[model samples]
Target: MNPIVYAIPIFFLMILIEVITTIIRKKDYYRVNDAINSLSTGMLNVTTGVIFKLGIYTLIYNHIALFSFDGNALWVWVLGFLLQDFFYYWNHRKGHEVNILWASHSVHHQSEEYNLTTALRQTSTSFLFSWIFYVPMATLGIPPHIFLTVSLLNLLYQYWVHTRHIPKLGWFEYVLVTPSNHRVHHAKNRKYLDKNYGGVFILWDRLFGTFIEEDENYEAIRYGTLKTLRSWNPVWANFHLYTEMLRDAIKTKSWKDKLTLWFRRTGYRPVDVATPMKMPDIHAYENYNPEASKGLKVYSLFQFAILVLATTVFMTISHNTPYGFNLLWTIVLALNLIGTGWLLEKYTGLIAVEAIRFVLSGATIFVSNGIWINLIPTWAWQFIIVSGAVSLLVLQASGIAKPGSNREGNTVRAAGS
Candidate 1:
């Protein structure tokens, strides 16, 4: 079983505890749409990883690993853990310093509010090059299972640090990455930018001169990128930076810049491309929260709950299913995420879009007479078809099916305006 599959219930349980604590303390740490968006991107990241990730590490270990060590040795496990975190520090640091890398990494930093949900908001595209950073483990002959265990440990360690509720631990703050130091890493404040890049240990940042402490009096740390993603669309969140880079790359007159701009510093723009005349005041920034009604929130959650279940099913069955089936299922889930985002944004036109999706999904399964029959059970297909019909009726009964009803903005504006 995937270690993450076991961690899934624990993740939700901890998040539930955080939600209850925030409510009791009146700290207002979560927004419904924001939390949902964070989880949506996370599901997208994990599902896409299953569909697209290749077994480079295992293959390399089998073929060209220079040193062989016993997979069961205690020293090997300790060394693997240390090496994983060491490389993770550089991988994370370079993610912020380089433009193309930042394009993918920026998804993790898109949310203005930091919490446990924020920890899951990962990038789907990091697999493109992030594997290069850990190839040394494979070359050093660390068993793939040990490499995986250490990697999961590094990831799980970072999750709890995303919360503001945890104060600095007295001694742990210096050795390990604590909430205090990790908060500095997420801040947009000029002094805090690109600081504290460690995963489990803070020593790497200290050694590299990238460490900065959370000050008592300097200023309240402002979270998020200088350029905020003001929308809740998860697919758009992943591509927004890439879109900007591509535009700049296309517009530049200099061939060198067109080719090398992605390798340059984060937020680099070619000379010919015009920078925005005005930028947001980082000190006075407001979160990108569009108002949503109670009904809309419920509807969005309903869809999100279903997607979560579907994602869990995908993760469980992906290894046993054909690669093509996995890819197709991933696309359906991604589109479902986009639809859910539209609903959260209060796009009144989403009724038509979602209705079409439900109908198409039902019809596809009905016509194919059990697509994924070997993997997904027949009852699951019936449930999907039934859910589609039920959702349509719910929309109609709630009057949300009416076009332009309770709309925050026109459909075009809701999308990106």
Candidate 2:
């Protein structure tokens, strides 16, 4: 009953359409590195969910809540959708207003571009608190299957809103979250900060007095947060806020401040631990895009695409594959993703890590033969090996991997640091 699994093709199709539209319009709304970082973040979330999500379902193992209506199917789903939306509004709003929650949620806002890719840039650790928000549904005896389905639908509804091409829908803007409304939510502009915090419905914001209409004099909406995440690494995007929070917590002398910093309101600064951070000019700031050569871009894209394909395979066939193979494959892919991110960011000496990954790719083939050989056809395996080796050779031939004496010019930061 996983609608998202079935919708993967549609998701990428829409992304493709958006890319084509960008080309037709002669706009640069999408960047290769930014989109790849977002996709990687999303893939990481899916992989981790496979491991940690069981704990959430296990919470309502066998207990029935107050209203376990077996007869009224329509009533259950309608109620489930409404109740879930209510909880989601709070979850999303609190995620913006609270420091600890914002730590995980900040990943979504890291991208300055408002497109389908930005929609996919979700948090890897949102599960820690997100499950708690849905506990009430389980308590109400909402069937898990129905709840999961509605949740998926709820998520699907939000996808189309993450675009710039769509104008504000006339009357529909009053009730549903739309592209216009979501654009305001993603804005770091002073007026739009923390406004319009609903996932599917704008009604919650209007009722709760958290709604703001986008003013054209706010002219162009500048996306992203005041404290910008100046990196392309998806792994860093998730934990950077938490890292900053931990540092602040350690600096404060008060035991209460030390522990409570995480729970405090968003952007709370302790006087004891304060360092003057140069706040970027919100209205006039550049996106955190670093430069890489054309060869490196092509090499990085090929490696990343292979990771995406591997993740897709894992998601589709996880049930058929052994737990060990799934676990091992995910580990290898995650590690590869880290190295790839480093390479994309122009980190030097990672050519050696790339070499190590080639070795690991071969090792994975041998180690996983018993599991995947029986599951997928033999040609698929040959495709993987032949394509991977060819990509590696092409990458080496690209010559950016081995920058020789000019290595410093190509590298943004020293790799493996």
Which parts of model 1 are misplaced by more than 4 Å? 276-280, 367-375, 400-417
Candidate 1: tens digits of C-alpha lDDT, residues 230-262: 888899999999999899989989999999999
Error of 1 at 34 (Å): 0.7
TM-score of 1: 0.93
lDDT (10s digit) by residue, model 2, range 154-236 = 98899989988777799999999999999899987777789998888899999999999977654567777789787767778
Clashing residue pairs in candidate 1 (N, C-alpha, C atoms within 3 angstroms):
none
lDDT of candidates 1 onward, in order: 0.84, 0.78
Off by over 4 Å in 2: 55-58, 275-279, 369-385, 402-417
lDDT for model 2 comes to 0.78
